[model samples]
Target: MVVKMNLKHVDELSGGRKRFRRRYPKSLVPVLGEAVFQVAMKAREGGALVSEWESLMKTYDRNVAKAERAAGVAGADDRLSPLELWREARRDAAAMLAAFKDDLTEDERRELLGDELERREADPVLYRAVVEPDAPEPKPTLLDAKNMYLQERLEGGTGRNNKNRLDRVCKRIEATLGPLNKLSLVDLTRDQARTLRDAMLSTRKADGTRLAPASVRRELDMIKAMVSLGIKEFGLQREADNPFIDLPISSKGVAPDVDSSKRDPLPKNVLLAMRDRMREKAQVPALGLIWRLLEGTGCRGAEVVGLRREDVVLDGLYPHINVAWHEDRRVKTKASIRSVPLVGDALVAAREALTLSEGEPMLFPKYARENGPDAASAALMKHLRTVTKNPRHVVYSLRHNMKDWLVLAGTSERVENRIMGHTVGGLGDRVYGGNDAKLKVAYEAMEKAIKGMP
Candidate 1:
């Protein structure tokens, strides 16, 4: 018979996977395997194994009696002593165990181990064995389906160094919800998932700083993904709900992101001041160009940093730069991989960068490491802080201010979205079409907006 799990709604859920075990007398099952014998001894040491032991003994004796009657052993071996009959049963138990040991596979062992841990937590005999004075520490679990998902992603070439992030997420999951580390997929109930969500919201960094709503939200997302692995790879329980799915992460009380630099529009005056400052400084070869490109083209810092000599087509009829993804580098989105007309300070900066890095494939080689985009953002952030001399004004504010610059110039939202290399907002948005007339209009609007700078 399959034993129901110890989960909150185990009684209600059908077809539980746990085993229904019956204990037997040690002599009748003389060799259940050395490991099993040791565990039983440890359980008995604390006086907790007696009931299970007696129950198994009775079951074994009853089964042997039925077998003897079926073969007419009572009449054929009537003179055989009771002690001799038990010895014969012991011989049969040893043969069965030896056959089981010969055929067990690694996959079966791991599943059994995870299941055993769940039983030990509540079983009096096993719980006593667990708390024995010199018992060995329980082993860490790394065989779960959630961990298997991580392994597949890490091995697959789809994401770059995503395993490290996922590994940290796994550790955080274990720390936030202690039982999750040891639980099987079916054992993870909806109620436990709800508890984990609250735990993550209240969690703080090691330095005692509470997580931002976005960070907490990401943690919840990761937890959901982990649980989904079990549902997708194996299967979810039909009776009990999977809390990771359809659970709302309520952001009712959390304030909007107060940091002005984060997706906040920069005032036009401060935007111009930062632009003028970058232009004034000529010591660094392409620093000014990077900043000016962000302001004029509305392109991300990484997109500018990853530009190749071929990408910067100053001699072309349109005089625009291509922002396509190369093998060594990546653009944020497919829309972000389009040509942006070089206008105003951006045109001057591009000409200067071409003069400096004439033969080099990459325009900005310093930031074009494997993860160039992230590095470029960091580089620009420091420059913005230094040039503005204000904690509030950031390099990213330049991109934010560009949207207003385009709209205020009466540039259609459609054209502005294309020029800015942003995702289309409406249902009938334009596809990738960089005709000369549209590029010229975008160039004129950008030039007009940034003209009266310095």
Candidate 2:
């Protein structure tokens, strides 16, 4: 008689449950049991368990169907007699044993099978290793460029405007310095620098206007700086000496009429009135303080945006703000990092507007500090005018206005320069061994200048 057993079905559930059910033909018992046992044995013998399990399922079905057909007939015998069936099963089992005969342990078989299964799931394409290009690698060029840029900024008394000018100059050079298929460094003579200067001058703007002299000068200066930097940074010279030596600067050369005027600093009463108006319109205490702080400290918009909570030292004996780090995490200049005492109206305003979170960056300022935030100081200026009837004001006018106030207050040039962090005009005495107290004193003067008003 055929030993029959119902088929048991197992299902996996997400909530840590295995569902089990039994159904169908009774004769399937031995077949399924044998199939399961064969699969388990294959798994233990370091065989392809999934393939082995599938093959066992097929074998079980064939045997069960043959047995059922035989049992249905009046005088039919089983598909295989008990000994024959045993022999067939033993032969199949022996094939699995032979395949993994060299394997030392059953655990190894299971481990190997698990590894194969994992590898199958995570199948990666096999590729031969390729040789990287022999081209000179991209060394720390960006960081080095940035460091050099900062160094120049600190040394040359450059500002945000100068940084922008250099950026534009480099971009233009990249455009012109291309298609160098034939021009070798050795082929370039000092006269080529003159030729380059002429070519850049002859280049037209999108509007067909000839390039401005200032623009040309800027480009030349950038090239000179690049050559100087190349000697220092990369030793990139065809000759032992640079070819750019003795390049001519025209005798009658006029300074290009680049607009150097910043927004006039708001007068003390106007600034206070503007603050009140901004607060009423923006309806945020922070917004009001934004104008207040700018008017009081004469900070550039970028410097204001770069302010952080930790940098604000309201708890100190002198109570000062460190204006060093930018929102993008770079100091504008070494001079920019020095602490400005929170004296005058700026101190009063900072203390009043101390509602900002300590660790998180200021949201309004983050826009300029980030890669693509709105940086047009004009926008803030426009918004301020919309709220107040004051004649249109430029954002930088605040600094200019403050400078005027400093002069009007009869504050000495040294005191004003220290507060503004303007490079001291004198050559010898200007070299500072440490932080200048004049910076703090300037803040005191600024505070006195503003507070002296109604």
Top candidate on TM-score is: 1
Q: Model 1: runs farther than 4 Å from truth? A: 1-168, 179-186, 204-215, 229-242, 256-263, 266-284, 387-390, 432-441, 452-454
Cα distance off (Å), candidate 2, residue 28: 56
Write model 1 residue lDDT over 1-454, tens digit each, in one string. Answer: 2111121111222332222244433443433321121112222111122223333444445554434443445442332222233344345433433444545664454345436645644322232232332334332122244454654433321223355566666666677655333555555667877777777777788879666667766766766766666556554446224567776667788776554425566666667666667667534657777777777777877778778777988885567899887643456677787778887668888888888776666777654444555655666676566645655566666666777777777878777888888786765555444467667876777777665333
| lDDT tens digits by residue: candidate 2, 1-454 | 1111111243334543333322426654553443332222222111132223334554555566444543453322223332233334344433543467574565564355445535654211100000111223222222233335545533323134665666665455445553222233333467767767777777788879777766677667765665556445544443434455656656255554444431344555666667667767754455556666777776666666556565677874567777775424355555555666666667777776555543344423333222211243545666656645545356667777777777878888876766665666666436754554655565557666765444
Error of 2 at 412 (Å): 1.7
Question: How high is the CA lDDT of each candidate model?
Answer: 0.57, 0.51
- Give the poorly placed runs of model 2, Cα more than 4 Å off: 1-167, 174-177, 180-187, 199-212, 238-246, 251-277, 283-287, 359-365, 372-378, 381-393, 425-440, 451-454
lDDT value for candidate 1?
A: 0.57
Model 2 scores worst on lDDT over the 10 consecutive residues at 123-132
- Residue 135 in candidate 2 has what lDDT? 22
Q: How does model 2 fare in lDDT?
A: 0.51
